[model samples]
Target: MKLAIVGGGSTYTPELIDGFARLRDILPIGEIALIDPAEQRLELIAGLARRILARQGSPARVTTSTSVTSGVDGADAVLLQLRIGGQSARHRDETWPLECGCVGQETVGAGGLAKALRTVPVVLDIAEQVRASNPAAWLIDFTNPVGIVTRALQDAGHRAIGLCNVAIGFQRKFAAHLGVEPERIRLEHVGLNHLTWERGVTLLDEPDGESGREVLPELLDRFGERVAQDVRMPLTLLESLGVVPSYYLRYYYQHDAVVRELGARPSRAEEVAALERQLLALYANPSLNTKPELLAQRGGAFYSEAAVQLIAALLGTDGRSRTQVVTTRNDGILPQLPDAAVIEAPATVDAKGVRPLPQRPLPPLFAGLVAHVASYEELAVRAAVAGGRARVFDALLAHPLIGQLDLADQLTDRLIAHNHGYLSWA
Candidate 1:
């Protein structure tokens, strides 16, 4: 099989390459195309990718390309990981929202909306090209604002599924705490990308199946403090909810505190920019044939394993339907959400397609927030696909984080101003 990674120039690419090398038996690839406009970075990543593959004695050929059309041509799967405006733009995304007293996160609030507007159009265009080149190819999106981007892809009728590392990261962490293998812990993870919760932890053998032994309560009881620290939430809150919320929830559950925290520190974008410099320097080392330890701090922890597992299951190479947390069409899995809404939930993936598994009803505490965010996401996709200042405002106003008309108005202006260069309709 042939695979192509758009934005393969990213510092995160090496982590992915390392996974492919280690898990080749699960998802064999005859070739890999690293697509990016940053030719120098592409060369550096591609060189390291080749070395990583060689160290494993795998014959998967690594190639670099500056053109998405050519890079994805005839590829079995196309992975989208590109950043539209790079970290400099991310710095803006993570900074400007604070001025409005909102959490300035890359995948939440006004900043996330800005990223959606900038990313959706490009992703759609690339999807179209992929369709032209290989209609059967799976477009795996690892892009931010995943719910919005994946909605756009599916809306356009492209074969796409969105992947994020949060669910897998949690699974691994929970498994370690339980002194069990990661595969034995099946997370009852629900909600949209980044905004999800672990409702249960079932110790099971298969990736997707009936609940084995319900162990979430026990795990929470024993390791509540550790889990709380991982999610950056208070143990009291965890005790109240009976579920572990993603760290992103902190932006909502404690918006004012997050705003103050962000204001007091450098934007995460700035920190990542510095880390990328160090990572690139490491990548430049000819002797370096493996992903560096510093790359782990660069974030996207367990990304490689998640990607490999999902791709393997998607391609039917895993030899059975696999349940993995992915962002895909709702398809009635969550009655609270429309079928067309893209949600991050556990789904059975196979060569035929992805099917969201049945889920218990979410109580008002979770469902209300899910519905509210789903509404905002709908408007967010609209503002992204068919641009207008009013649409952007409506989406922001709909967001729980920016419900006030005045704040939404201010944020809309700031978003367009900061991202006008990337938004054609601005």
Candidate 2:
């Protein structure tokens, strides 16, 4: 089989590369391709990927391409790790929403919509290229604004999987909270990308094995404080939910939640600069190992992500295990959202491909929490694929931040302008 990374120069490439290299023992061998527009960074990351492969003495082919068509042609899997306009654009994405009196945050409310508008077309073009070049390729997207872009691809009828490592990551935290081995815990959850839930959990082998037996103590105040200030964001949401969430939370904390929390909002520019400086500096720093170490380090974090490993565990050679997955479809899963809306949950995968677990009703707390966000995600998908002002307006109004402003019309005008060229409005 073959594997390709669409935005190969990504700062996170090494994590996945390192991840796959270690998996050589379990999965079949294959060639790998790296595609990126940033020539220097692409070459650097490619070189690192190759060196790592060579060091491990793995026979996986490593090729570099400036074009997605060439990179993904005839591939088994395509990993999309794209960040359009890089740091410069992300700064605007993070800062603008707050200026408009909306909770300016990343990957959730208005901030994400702005990013989604600019990102959808580029990602759609990439999806089209993947479809044309390799019809059977499964696009494993790890991009941010993941919910929006993935929905666009699904709406356009492309084969893709929006994989987030959050589930397993949170499972570990929850397991710790409940004093159980992470692996033994079984779960069911539903929500958008970074924002999610822990509806239930159980020991795999225990009798009368239900959640009522496990007692969860309180940690919200402490957890909330930890997540709110740190740049490693996502911790705050975990604290907020009374579960330790995965990913960074500093960006998520500055939103309307600031008002919800203490009525004090920090400077937006300061928030944007945190990640901006890190990525720009990483790119600037010459220490980025462009040698064999790159591949060695690539994908080092996947053990925890468990998306591919979970698929492998359930479907590959030792086939039979299963888990929850996020799937798009308004269907029986969530009564509030449309039947075609994409929802995240546990799934089963094997040689037969993926099957969404039977739809489980979301709890009132989480259901009410994510309802508007889910609406934004669904509407954003329509805006990207259908490209009408109505869809854009719907997406804008559907967001918690925008709705809080009660100026959906104004927010809609601004968002449309922010993402003006990313769509095909008539």
Candidate 3:
């Protein structure tokens, strides 16, 4: 199989290379094309990718390119990981929203809407090129504002699926606490992209074998402190909700506190920018083939595994009806949201494509929030595709985080002014 990574120059590429080398048996990739406009970074990362493959004694050949058309041509799967304006733009997204007293996140609040407006057009253009190159090739998106981006691609009639590592990260953590392999844990993760919860964690491959022994409560009881700390939520909240919220939920569950906290610390984008510099220097080392430990700090934990597994399943290399969490169009999976909205949930993946598993209706508390966010996502997509200040304002107004008309107006103006270059239609 030939796989192309769009943002192959990113510091996170090495972690993906490591996964490809280690999990070769699962996907058996024959070639990898690293596609990026940053030639120097791409060359450095490509060298490391080759070295890692060689050290693992894998026959997969690694290549680098600045042309998406040439790089993705004939590839079996194309992975989207590009950031529209890099971390510098992300810093703006993270910092500017706080000025409006809204959560300064890249994929949730006004900032996320800003990112979507900047990102969707570029992603669609790339998807068009991929289709022209290889109509059969699957598009695996790991881009931010995934729920919105994925919906755009699907609506445009592209074969695409969005991926996030949150569920896998949770699974790994839960597995460790249960003293079991990660594969044995099955998470009933449900919601739209960043707004999700692990309602149930069943032991799938264990002796109990699909008996549906939910371990979420046990995990909360035994490892509540650790989990709570990681998510930055009060343990009591978990006890009260009876479900573990995704770390992204912190911006919502504790909005005022998060605003205060964000005001006090440097934005996450700043920290990642510094870390990326260190990672690039390490990648330039000729002797360094294995991924540096610092790469873990770069985030997207287990991303490579999720991508490989999903790609394998999509191509029918893995015949098992693997229940994996992914973002795809909602075809009545939620029953509460529009069928066109993209949602993140556990789905059975195979050669036919992803099929979202039936889920119990979300409780009113969670349903209301999911529906509210889904409305924002819908408007965000429209605003992104059909660029107009009014569309942008309406989307912001619909967002639960920025419902006030005046605040919505402020956010819309800031978003357009900051991202005007990327919004050609505006």
**For candidate 1, lDDT tens digit of each residue in 1-426?**
999999999999989989998999999999999999999989999999999999988889999999999999989899999799999999999999999898898899999999999999999999999999899999999999888999999999999999999999999999899888888889899999888999988988554446579898898899999999999999999989999999999989999988999999999999999999999999999999988999989899988899998889888886877888999999898998899999999888888889888999999999999999999999999999999999999999999998998999999999999999998888
lDDT of 3 by residue, 12-35 (tens): 988888998998888899999999
What TM-score against the true fold does each predicted structure earn?
0.98, 0.79, 0.98
Cα lDDT of candidate 3 equals: 0.91
TM-score of 3: 0.98
Which ranges of candidate 2 are over 4 A from the true structure?
A: 175-181, 205-304, 310-321, 327-330, 388-390, 404-406, 421-426
RMSD, each candidate, Å? Answer: 1.1, 5.2, 1.2
lDDT of 3 at 239: 91
Q: Relative to the unseen true structure, what is the C-alpha lDDT of residue 263 in candidate 3, on a scale of 0 to 100?
A: 85
lDDT of 1: 0.92
lDDT of 2 by residue, 347-424 (tens): 666656666677567667667756767777878777766677777778887775565435767766766776665556
- Between candidates 2 and 3, the one scoring higher on lDDT is 3
Distance (Å) between predicted and true CA of 31, model 2? 1.2
All models: lDDT?
0.92, 0.63, 0.91
